[model samples]
Target chain A: MSGPAGGGRAGSVLALVGNISARSLRVWQRNRDVYFVTWKTNLVPPLLEPILYLLAFGAGIGALVSEVQYRGEMIGYTTFIAPGLLATQVMFQAFFETTYNTFVRMYYQRTFDSIMTTPLTLEDVMAGELLWGASKGVIGCAVMMVALSAFGLLRYPHALVIIPFSFLAGLLFAGLGLCFTGIVPQIDSFNFPTFLFVMPMFLFSGTFFPLDVLPRWAQVLAEALPLTHVANLMREAALGRLPADLLRDLLYLAVATIPLCVAGIHLMRRRLVK
Target chain B: MSPVIEARALTKRYGGLAAVDGVEFSIRAGECFGFLGPNGAGKTTTVRMIYCASPVTAGDLRVFGIEVGDRPREIKARIGVCQQEDTLDPDFSVRKNLTVFARYFGIPAARAEERSRELLEFMGLWERKDARIRELSGGMKRRLAIARALINDPDLLILDEPTTGLDPQSRHQVWDRVRGLRRQGKTILLTTHYMDEAQTLCDRLVIMDHGKILVEGPPVDLVRSRVGKEVVEVEGYPPGLVQHARQSGWTFESDTGRLFIYTDSGEAVFTVIAHQFPSERCTVRTAGLEDLFLKLTGRELRE
Candidate 1:
C-alpha cells in the first residue's frame, strides 16, 4: 500500500509535501496587497500598543518596583518588561492574523477557495497564509521596536537581532493559531483558545517577571510555554547580554516551529480538502 | 483532436452516501456541454471533480487528456471555474481581483495587468474596474468572476449554475456573454437545473438524477425522441379523453383536471382531443426540453 502507487500513510504525507511550491508566495502576496489597502488602520495598533504598555506597566509600575534581578545584576523594571512587550507583540500579531483574520478569509471571504481554483493547491494556500502571519509579527515587532527605542529601552546592535527573531517566534505562534483555526467549529469558538490557551500563556509565561519568583511547580509549567523561550531571547537581545544558556531557548524555538508549521498545514488540509 | 474531458465510472462518496456514483460521459473540444439535474442530483459534485476542487472516490476522471488525480495542477492550470457561489475576494477591488487571481496561474505581472484590462472590457466591467466587490451588483459580480476566470486564458471553462439566482434581464445578459465565449470556440462545461437554460446554451447535455445519468443527447433530439415535436394540453379534460388516448396508443399523462398528449402532429392531436373535450380547453404548443426532463425524472419535488 505504501509503494509507487502513492497509497498508504507515508505516501500521503509525501503527496502533501509535494503539493507545496513557490506558488505559495502568491497567497502571501494576496494578503500583502490587502494589508497595504488598510495599512493605516493596521499601523495604529502596533504603534500604540508598546507605548501604552510602557506607560502603564513600565513607568507606572516601575516607579514602585524600582529594579529587578536579572542574570546576576539588577536592571530597571521598565527595561526588564520592555523586551517582554516586544515578544508579546510578536505573539499577538501572529496569533491574531492566523486565527480570527485567517478564519475570516477562509470561511467568510472564501479567499482560499478562490485561490485553489487556480493552479494553486490547498497546501500552497495555507503555507502562504503561515508566511504572511509570520510577516505580520515581524512588521509589528519593527513598529514596536521603534516606539520602545524612543524611551532608551532597547540596546544597540544586539537589539537589531530581535527583528529577525520575532519572525521565528511569529511562525511558531502562527502555526499554533492555525491549528486552532482548523479545529474550531465556528469563529466564535476561537474565544475558547484565546482565553484558555493564549490568555494563560500571556499572563504566566514570564512576560511580566522572572520565572524564579514563581513556586517550583508553577516555574516548571512556565518553562513549558513557548512564550517563555521567546521572552527569554528578547530580554537577552534587549539588554545586549547574550548568555550561553540562550542557545537552549533558540534551539527550543527552532524545534517547536517546524513541527507546528507542518501540523498546521495538515490540519488545515483536513478542514478544507474533501 | 482528442476529447477535452472524459469520465468513466466516476464516483464521489461522502461516507456511505455517494454524491456522484459511476457517472460516465465525455466532452468534445470546442463544444458547449451541459449537465442538467435538479438539486442533490450530483451536477455540482461532478463539475467540482472536473475542476479538481473535489477528489474522485473511485474510477477515472480526466481533463485535457490528463488524469485529474495525477498532476492536478497541470489540469487545473488549463481550466477556469466560475463556482456556484460568489467566491470573489471581497477585500480587493474588481481590477485587483483579476490581477491577483492571474498571479496564482503564474502569469507574469505585466501580462496580468494587460489581461485584466482586456477581460474587464470584455465583460463590460471596465468602468468599474477599481470598485470594491461589495459595491458591484449581483450581475456585475458574476461577470467579474467570469472575467477573473479568463485571466489565465484557460482552454476549458466550467460554469456551475452560472445564473442560478438572477433576474430575467441579468440572466439574458449572462447568456449573451456565454454565447460570446462559445463563438470564440472555447470548450465549455455548464451545469444547470433550469431546462430553458440547457436548451438555450447546450449543444449536448445529460439529465442526471439519483447520482446517475438518466439520458444524454442534444436537446432537440431528446425532446423529439423522448417526448415529441408537439404537445396538446387539455384543460377540464373528460374521462373518455384519457380512455381515447390510451386506446389510440398515444403517449399521455393525466393530472387532476388536465391531460397532456405528446405527438408529432399537434394539430391532429388537438383536433381529436377537442372533439370530446371543449375546444377552448385544448391548446397545442411545441415540445421542449422541459417535457423530456419531466418525463424522464418525474414531476416529484427533489429535496
Candidate 2:
C-alpha cells in the first residue's frame, strides 16, 4: 500500500536481471510466509525506537533550541529530526535482513541449500534475498511515516514519497550487506564492518543533525555518505518541496546501486556456487 | 537396460587433495544401486558431484545421459536428492517445507499443495503435517526430507547415507519406504555404511575405499567372491597360531590385531578354531559385506 514493494522489486535490476526470473519471486513468497509468524517482532525496532527518539530529542530537547531555519520558514527541531529517523530506519531494517538473516538462513538453517537442490539457481536466491530486504525496508519506512504523523510532526502528504525513497535506500544497504555476507567466514566478523563502517555513517551522515553545523572538513566528508543524500531527500519530501539537486542525488543513488548489487551477487556466488 | 547414471574416471579435488579420484561406475535403469564405504571413503563426495553440488574435477559424469557440467539445471530438474545432512527449513512446517520446495521446481501452487498432501500421506506424515521442523523427531525429519525429495516425482532419486543416525525402528520404516519405492520401479542411487541396509535394499552395489572401487557386484556374489561363503574369527591368537593355520592350508587373513579365517567350510574351520583357541575366543558366521568393508577400508578411525 505504501509503494515500498515497487522500490524493492526495482532494486534487483542492477544485479544482473538476466540471471533472475519469475522463479525468484517464489523466494520472496517464502519469506512472506515467515513474516506472518514474526511480523510483531520485526516491526519493533524500526517502529518503536523512532518514536522514542522523537519524544526524547524532539520534545524534551526541542524546548531548549529556539528555532531551526528551513526553506523560508523557522521549523521546530522535531520536524527536522523526524525525516532523518525515517531514512535511518530503512537502512537499519534492510541491513539486518541481508546480513544476519541471510547468514542464518544460508549457514545455520541451511534454507538456501534446501532451495538450491531444486531447479532454482544461486542467482534466483540472491535476487530473492535482495527483494526481501527491500520489502522490509519499505515496510519500516511506511510504519515510521505513520508514527511521525501520529507525533504531529509530518508536514505534508507529499512526504509519502519517502516510502519509495526509503525502499531504494533499503536496497542500497541490503546490497552492501550481502557483499559482507558473501565474504564473512564467521558471524563474529560482522562486528568489524558494522562498527567501523555502518555506525560511523549513522552518526556522521547528518542523521541526527544537519551537516553544515559541523566543521567544513567534516561537512566535506559527510558529502561522500549515501545517508546524507537520503536525509536531504527525505527532508525535501517532508517540507513539500523538491531539491534543485534532486537529479544529482538520484543519479548518485542509482550509480552506487550498480556496483553494490553486482558485487553482492558476485560475492555471494563465490561463497555459494561450488 | 540403459544407464540412469554413468561416471567414467570422475574425479573431485579440494585444493591439492582428491576427494573422489577417477571413480568409474554406471547405474542401470529401475534398479537400486548403492555405494558402500567407510568415513572419508568418498561416498558423500561422489554423490555431491552427481547432484551438481560440486563440479567434477576430471573425467566424464552424466545423469540421465545428459552431461552434468554442460546442463546441470536440466539434469537437476529430473533428479531428487536426499543429502547427507538434514537441510530442512526450521522456519516452515512439514507441509510448507515440501510445498515451498515444489515451487522451486516450478510446480504450480495448486499442484504443489496436492502433491505435498500425497507425499505427506505416503510418508506417513499426514497427521503431523502441521508440525514445525524443530518439533519432529530425527526419523520424522528424515522422512519429511524424503517426502520433499519426492514432491517433483523425480525420475532418479539419490539418497546419501539415508539412515545413518536412525534407530532400528526408524531404519526399518525408511527401508520399508525404500523397498516400496523400488517395487514401483524408481531408479535409485544410494550411499551408506550400513551393510545390512545395503544388503537388504540394494540389487547391486560397489564397495569403495580411498576413492576407488575395491569390489562391485550383487551382495551375495560380492560376499562369495571376496570373502567366500563363511568366516571364522580366532580372537587373541598369537602370530604363531596364524602361521600354524597358514602352514596347515587354512585360507585366512591376518588383519589388525585379529585373525580372520575365510573358508567355504565353516564347520571345519569352527571346529579347528574352537579346539586350538579358547572356546570363548572362537566363533563362525556367514560372510557378508561388513567383512569385505572392513577388509578393504581397514579398521582405522576416519575423521
TM-scores of all predicted structures:
0.97, 0.94
Count backbone clashes in candidate 1: 0
Tens digit of per-residue lDDT, candidate 1, span A187-208:
9999998999988888888888
**Which residue pairs come into collision in candidate 2?**
none
**Most accurate candidate by DockQ:** 1
lDDT of 1: 0.90
Q: A-chain TM-score per prediction?
A: 0.96, 0.90
lDDT digits (tens) for residues A1-274 of candidate 2: 1011354545544334556677889899999889887778977877788879977887788779745775457777888888888878878888888999999999998888778777777778888998889889898888888888887767677787887888788888889899999999988888988898888888888777767678999998888888888888888888777767877777777788767877898789779766
Residues B117-224 of candidate 2: C-alpha lDDT, one tens digit per residue: 998988999999999999999999999999999989999999999999999999999999999999999999999989999999999999988788888889999889
| Lowest lDDT 10-residue stretch of candidate 1 chain B | B271-280
Which candidate number would show the highest lDDT if scored against the true structure? 1
